[model samples]
Target: MANFSTNEFKAGLKIMLDGEPCNILENEYVKPGKGQAFNRVKIRKLISGKVLEKTFKSGDTFEGADVLDTTLAYLYNDGEFWHFMNNETFEQIAADAKAVGENVKWLVENDDCTITLWNGNPISVTPPNFVELEITETDPGLKGDTAGTGGKPATLTTGAVVRVPLFVQIGEVIKVDTRTGDYVSRVQK
Candidate 1:
């Protein structure tokens, strides 16, 4: 494993801390009036999704973690694990509910997702920025509301609910921003 000195610490850098893999979220250099310089870092554990803050003396080193991000196509969820496959390699990997977390709501079969792997195993999953899904359920739109003056809650095909324009209706496909769970617009198709 490679060692990362405190000076080289930066956001998104993966390192081993207390035998666990963690990604640096923030690194702040601090120097007291009379003491040596130090680095204050905020990191998130790869496996448990926990955030922690720690301070290290200048020039301190940490072992690098074996972490990689790969894009895979979602296959299916078998109740316990969500499966994904590498389109080019045809290799498949299973991630447990903990790894998928809330992103599972945005996942649809055949969709490409970025999976973060630690030591060759999935630690986290990231859904795409936008997705188009059919509205499975929603109240009927009011008459003459085609101008989209207001919004109403609508259930999507993937089971995630978001506020859509009044003109949106059930069975209509709408574009959604996954990161904010906001309705972008009604899909023409």
Candidate 2:
């Protein structure tokens, strides 16, 4: 356990409050020009996914949670457990699908991801910000539609659909923005 002042709050920094794990989502140092400096923090509960706003004086200290992050390679799912192996140690840990949530969509075999460990147990998995996937299905691009002003829906090999430009064609590889699930641009083959 460690102590952090309110001014040190940052996103993804886990802190304990009322015997529960909470992470700082966003923190802003505010001073009303007449009052003492304070930190306005938007915190999210790790287990319940609840978000709350709290204020603390700049000099206040809080108990920070002991969280460990390790790079893990994603392995295949065994119907119940999603397995991952630490790249450095080759140690395996299996987490349930519910624990992985929508992040499972971005999991490609052998892909490396950061696993957040709380009390030596996997609590969350964060995938890469971007991934390249081949377009499996999409209508043929309109002939002579070089305007590139509109987009059409296309399905990727992962079964995730995204809007690609009208120039995109089936069997073409494209870069996908995992954060927004939107097509960035078609990859040059």
Each model's lDDT:
0.91, 0.83
TM-scores of the models, in the order given: 0.92, 0.80
Best by TM-score: 1
- For residue 141, model 2's alpha carbon misses the true position, in angstroms, by 2.3
Expressed as tens digits, the lDDT of each residue in 1-189 for candidate 2 is 889888688898899987767889999989989989988999987656689999888889999987777888888889898899987888999987656877777777788887877788877788777887888999998766763577889988878888887878999998888888878877888
The residue-by-residue lDDT of candidate 1 on 96-144, one tens digit each, is 9989998888998899999999889998999989988999999998856
lDDT of candidate 1 vs native?
0.91
Can you give the lDDT of residue 20 in candidate 2?
Answer: 69
Minimum summed lDDT over a 10-residue window in model 2 is located at 142-151
For model 2, name the residue pairs that clash: none
* Candidate No. with top lDDT: 1
